[model samples]
Each structure stands twice: as structure tokens, then as C-alpha cells.
Target: MATLGTVTFNNSSATSIFHTSSSLKFSSKPLLLPTRFSPKTPFPLRILRIYALSSNDIKVGTNLEVDGAPWRVLEFLHVKPGKGAAFVRTKMRNYITGNTVEKTFRAGSTIDEANVFKEAKQFTYKDGSQFVFMDLNTFEEIRLNEADVGDKTKWLKEGMDCNLLFWNGKVIDFELPITVQLAVVDVDPGLKGDTVSGGSKPATLDTGAVVNVPLFINIGDQILVDTRTGQYMNRA
Candidate 1:
């Protein structure tokens, strides 16, 4: 009987070998394959692959999938005892729930790398309770509910650029710029003795977020705010 040389393929690349009675043909060029597999593909190659990472590969900002959830590594430490196998200790935060958890893994253990990515989006407006964002690249409007926006809703302003976090091609969360400048819409009048360090007052921003500002800050003043802590930074 006659046989054709082995053929191997995957989502990224493929190779084919042809064999005959006279000689063997070898092609070193990598064959281009689709990024995705079709349902009709062979059972062995039909499934998509999720990259595996060694415990030693974990580092801050690394995204991982654990217990069926996507988590970002906030901190990691390597421990090697006197007479035991090495291990990794990690603190991870869930992308969806914003919860932090401590997990340990044996050295050289395999971990699933989460398919997480971010897309640039611009805040367009609010439709009822949903906030609409337009993808900078695709120009597609993505509507996120109130809960998804959470406390960040206060910092959202029309035309503001933000980063939308995606896991498995779906939006999991969004992040605003670390600092934003907004006009103070309302605040109590400052006294004659008021100074930058004299006292503080609650100031309502044009976007409806209230933050504590130095007594010297007044209505219609443009002030910079820290989005992470919702605190007034300084005059813009």
C-alpha cells in the first residue's frame, strides 16, 4: 500500500508532508490556517486552545482564569522552603465582581491564561439607566447597565475616552482615566479667612459627582479629580 506523509495543522500554522517510493518531499514553509476552527474540523483539532502558564510565570497584571472566573493578578510571591517544593502565592482580583482572593499554586503547575483585553471607548450619553459608549476602533455603540458602570458613573462625561475590559470578547468592566477635570457646579461660598489648608467643603461637579475640595474652591471653578478615590486633586 502507498501512504502520504503525516499532515499536521492547528489554528495558527500547519505543515504537510508528501511521501513516494522514490523520495520524501519536505516543505519547511508554515501553512497559514484560520484563527478559529470549524465545527466540521477533525475532533482532535476542532477545539480552541487556551494558553497554559506555569506558576512561575505569574506576575502583577497577569490575567488568569480560575474557578471559571477571570482574575487579574495584583501581587505574587515565590516561596521555596528548606525541604519542600517551591510554590507561588498570589493575590488576584476578579474582573467582574471586583473581589480579591489569595491563592497558592505549586511550582511548575499549569494555569489557564484568561483571554482578557481592553478596547478604547468614548462615552456618548445615557439612555435611561444604561450608559452608551462608542468603540473608538469599530464605532459600535456598547450599552452597559447601571450596575456595570457602578460608582464610575459619576465620572462619566460625554466625549470622555475610557477603556472597556473584555473577557472572551464580552465586556467585563470599564476604566476611566486616573484623573479628570470638571467644573464645580455647586459649593458653599468661602469665608474671608478661607485658605487652601484652612478647611474643606463638598463640591458638586458638573457631572453630578460630589467631592471634598479645599475651601478656596468655588462654583464654576475647574478642578481636577482622582477617579480612583473620587477626591479633588487640584485646580485644573
Candidate 2:
């Protein structure tokens, strides 16, 4: 029996050290156990962490390593089955191809986390085949070639802000502003009383991207265009 005046400790190594004395005034309270522990992972376990993750541990806006590339999670939902185990449903976008994927994972499943970094960069002048960008926080210049930028190069403008994505220290992708203001370099003039909402005409922007704008849009007019779809959004 434990003495009433002093605390007795259990020396078992399998348990944690967090405990309360049985002689304390609140002796009726149960002992508290830790929910999780930070233990050193084994070598084999480390290799398994390369591309696996528990369904409950996934979060939106996080990068997951699938196959040889990184994919960014756009949405996630947790589902519980009455007859089976719980699972997670996720909608992820490929950082390399700009494609989307819908995946499901069991409650205890694991997936690898992608090693990705993002930097706020300002677009600079383009060289022979390379586009230059300056890090906004460090002012360091980085030059990426056509292949590194993919189709995103068409969206860049000098001195414009861009979000640069790096996968394992290699330039991979870039995200453009949702809406950009551009002047129409060429467009056919619309007639008076041509206020039809269904009317449309092709207009060429200063950047050379041709878009179908409403009849009212004219040459030299500055308008907002969505970069994702290359569509006119509104007048700037």
C-alpha cells in the first residue's frame, strides 16, 4: 500500500512520467495519460514516409508528393462509413501539368508530403530565352528559361508581382493574378444603339492575347481580364 504522507511512483519504462501522487487531496481523480509521443522514427519507417500520410492528417493548401511530382490540395472532405472504415476525399491540383485529381484515402493511410517552396517575385525583363525575376523579400534575381516557366510565361509583365513555385529547389510553376488590366490594341468599333448583351467581338490586347469582349469594348480601352481563362471580366 502507498504511504498517505508521500507519493509513490511507478518505475515501468513502458509508461510515461506524467503522474499525480495517490496521497493528494484529489485522490479520486484518474491518472492522465499523454495522447501522443515524439519518438525517434526507425530507418525503414523513414523510407515509408516518403509518399504516405494518414487521411485525418491531411490539410487543404498543403502539397502532397504523388508519383514524382508535387500536387497541391484544393479541397478535402472526411467521410465516415456505417459499414466500413473512415476515409478522406481530396481534390488536388497538379503543380507540373496544372491538372486536377480527385483521390480517396483510408483513415490510417499515409501519403508523402511534397517539398515545395513559394516566393513572392517581381517580373523583370526577358533575355534571349530566359525570363528574369527578382525576389521581393531578398531582391535576388532568378532567371528561368522557357521550359521552366511553361505557358505561364505569357502571363508575366515587367515589374508585375508573381508567385513563383519551386519544387525541391527547381523552378516548376507560377501563378498569375486572377484579373489583370490590359489595354486593347485593336478592335472593331461598335455602332450606336448596339447595346445587345449577347453581342461579342474579338479584341487583341497589348500583350497579344486575343479575347472575345462585348461589343462596347473598343480600342485603347483598359479592361480587366481573367488570366486563368483569358476572358474579359470588366472595364478597368
Candidate 3:
């Protein structure tokens, strides 16, 4: 399918990548891509750039500041095809848009790395456009908005602990735990034979997030969900 604003890795070198099955593997060709990317910038692509890093300088989980957007390396593959110069194939997901892209690079190709760091913080509240977080140890309050945390805000729950991602000391994003337990605030009444394999039903979580749970799940039930997919895991 067509992707609106995904990066085209020009001149990539050796790297790795993951396929549709979410399994890690090595490949030299581009794979199917997500539909759309987010966060439009007013300036031209090259103007607000930073950190022109080489192909070898990045690894899985490296963040890049691409055209004023935050992108993370999901996977990469290094190819040494005899017919061509070695190249690195990599998959990138934009933090702002949540879109994934595949790019190839050789020795000269470069990507801009994002200067970011993460801090442990507790969710306090939202003040205007900014969300408030307090450092557990330092007890210092950090205020950040959409430009910082992206879409993760929807899952934010008061008193929940999370990792606040900062770029140049500015709030850029936040991450919840890998798996979190949330109370089911709304869901259809469970029926018989609603075991894990039977079927699934939509449930509204306490955080205002909706996820599919097994037929046995009911309102007031606490369930564990994988934050990465927002999918139901098991009973809390």
C-alpha cells in the first residue's frame, strides 16, 4: 500500500528488520508499510535537522530526529550482496505519526539521531495542553504536551508511573509499562462458554481506552493489557 510520509532510506548499509509476523529476521528488500505517518512541519525537511549519523552508528531502538519528527529504529538488516556494495536495511517507526518505514543505506547514507533521554515520572494531571508528571526521586514536576508524548496520552492514568521521553531536555514523549492492569469500566455482560478461545468482546478500560477482551470479561473486572498493542492479555 501507499504510505504518505514514510522515510525512504537512501544508501543504507548492513542492518536487520522484522516482518509482519512481528518476528525478527534479516532481509534486503522493503516490506509492506503502514498507511500513514503523523505530525506535519511547516519548515522544509532539511532545515530543522540534527545529528547526521552513519548507518553503522544506529542500532535497534535508536531514535532519530527526521525532518523535525521523532522516529525509532524497529529492526535492521545488513546485506552483503556480491553484486552490489553492502547496505543496511532498516525499519523505522515515527513517534509522532506512529507510521513505519523501511529504508536502505550504504556508506554515505545518513540519518539524523534524536537527542533524547528518558526519566521515570508519575502522572499527576493535565494542565491545559501540557500533561504534568513528577519525578519519583527528585520530586520535580515536568509539564509537557502533545508535541512531547504523541498519542500515548490517551492511555495516561493519574498516579500511573511512566517514562517521560525528552528531546534536548524538552518533553517529547511518554511510555507506559509494557503490560498494565486496568479496570474494565464498561463491557457487555459475560455469557456462558466465554473462555479465552471462545470469542472476544469490546471493553472500555478505566483509562478511557478500548480493547477486546475474552467473552468472560465483564465490567469491574481488572485485566492486563499489552501496551504496545493495546490488546488484552489476562486477568489482572
Ranking by TM-score: 1, 2, 3
What would the per-residue lDDT of candidate 3 be over residues 1-236, giving only the tens digit for each residue?
42254333322322421123546453566433333422332111221123468787778998877767788999988888889688888899977567899977785566667766677889888888888888776667877766666667657778889987765435656789888878999999997777746788889998888998889998999989888988888998
Off by over 4 Å in 1: 1-49
Off by over 4 Å in 2: 1-53, 57-60, 75-77, 97-102, 136-138, 196-198
TM-score of each: 0.76, 0.67, 0.66
Best-fitting candidate, measured by TM-score?
1
Instruction: Please give, for residues 1-236, the per-residue lDDT of candidate 2 as tens digits.
Output: 32122223223311222244655343333333322212321101111112345568888988888777799999999999899888999999998788998998888665667757666788888999998988765567888888877766655678788877777545678778888888899999977766666788999888778889989888999988888898889888
Q: How many residue pairs clash in each candidate?
A: 0, 7, 22
Deviation of model 2 at 105, angstroms: 1.4
Question: What's the residue-level lDDT of 11 in candidate 1?
Answer: 25
- Per residue, candidate 1 scores C-alpha lDDT tens digits across 45-96 of 3223356678899999999989889999999999999998999999999998
lDDT against the true structure, per candidate, is 0.79, 0.72, 0.72
